[model samples]
Target: MAVKVKKIERKKMPFLERIYIFYIIAGMARTFRHFIRNLLNTKNIEFLEYPEQKPEDITPRYRGLHRLTKYESGELKCVACDMCATACPAKCIYIEACEVEGSKEKAPKVFNIDLLECVFCGLCVEACPKDAIRMDSGIFTKVEGKREDFISDINELSSRKRGDF
Candidate 1:
């Protein structure tokens, strides 16, 4: 048996439609009309003075700045198990563990996180067994002059308070 195939036909647009200038002009005119209408109506003008005024509410699930939690005894809760550093996908975390003077538990002598390298995936926080690390401080990350400024030290991370959003 022989199969017959039909040729597909495509409708060609008019010369005016083929040249996109007319469509472009029509779109621009529509945009201009909306702009004029919005400009005339004061209620349609939606502008916020940022920097001077921050948004009143931030989402509760927003992962902002990282903070190291402390124990009730005023000591750092991190046992320096390297779990967070190991779990970091970006390898931004760096930790140096040292034996505590009198305690059997090891403490982090130096803990640093390179903000530039961090992807902010919250994996480090999830890997921490002692609940030492958290990203709920609500502190906004600031622009720094030097690369070294982006590397947050153990003290800075531990000092962060749960800020009001």
Candidate 2:
């Protein structure tokens, strides 16, 4: 196939446009304004020197890690539906589902959230027909020795009260 090429033209910027110092000063002013506001209002601070202070709680709507759930009867709530795993665009969720006693549908007996790969997009929780898997856990991740170490149990993930979840 033959292709035709067009000439590229470059334009020169005027004095003010070429000298980016104006932009720099504007940025500095904005940054200082934010800093001043944050200094006065503790809520506006963006930087966190972690381990020095208690971490701020994420909103109940904010999704962090993945979690499995159980019915009030102590039966697995996941029904092995695979909705969460299927909805995961990152493909980070791994669920090994097995049948529960006297149940027709399967449930995830071994569900693992790969913290290394999880994008934490919250799609998994939204896709679940059952309110089984949730990211509403305000627990920001703690340190783990390995990637596998970050793989926490449901109890660890759901350390807070039912209201917290």
Top candidate when judged by lDDT against the true structure: 1
Q: Name the 10 consecutive residues with the lowest summed lDDT in model 2.
A: 156-165
Candidate with the greatest TM-score versus the true structure = 1
lDDT of 2 by residue, 4-76 (tens): 9999998988889898989999999999998888889997556768646645565667665565666778665
lDDT for 122 in candidate 2 is 87
- Candidate 1 weakest lDDT stretch, 10 residues: 48-57
* 135: Cα error in model 2, Å: 0.8
Please list all clashing residue pairs in model 1, or write none if there are none: none
TM per candidate: 0.72, 0.65
Candidate 2 has a TM-score of: 0.65
Error of 2 at 127 (Å): 0.7
**Candidate 1 residue spans exceeding 4 A from truth:** 1-51
Across 1-165, the per-residue lDDT of candidate 1 in tens digits comes to 999999999999888889998889999999999989998997968776764666677786778879899988989999999999999999999999999988899999999999999998999999999999999987756678999999999999999987777
For residue 139, give model 2's deviation from the true position in Å: 0.3
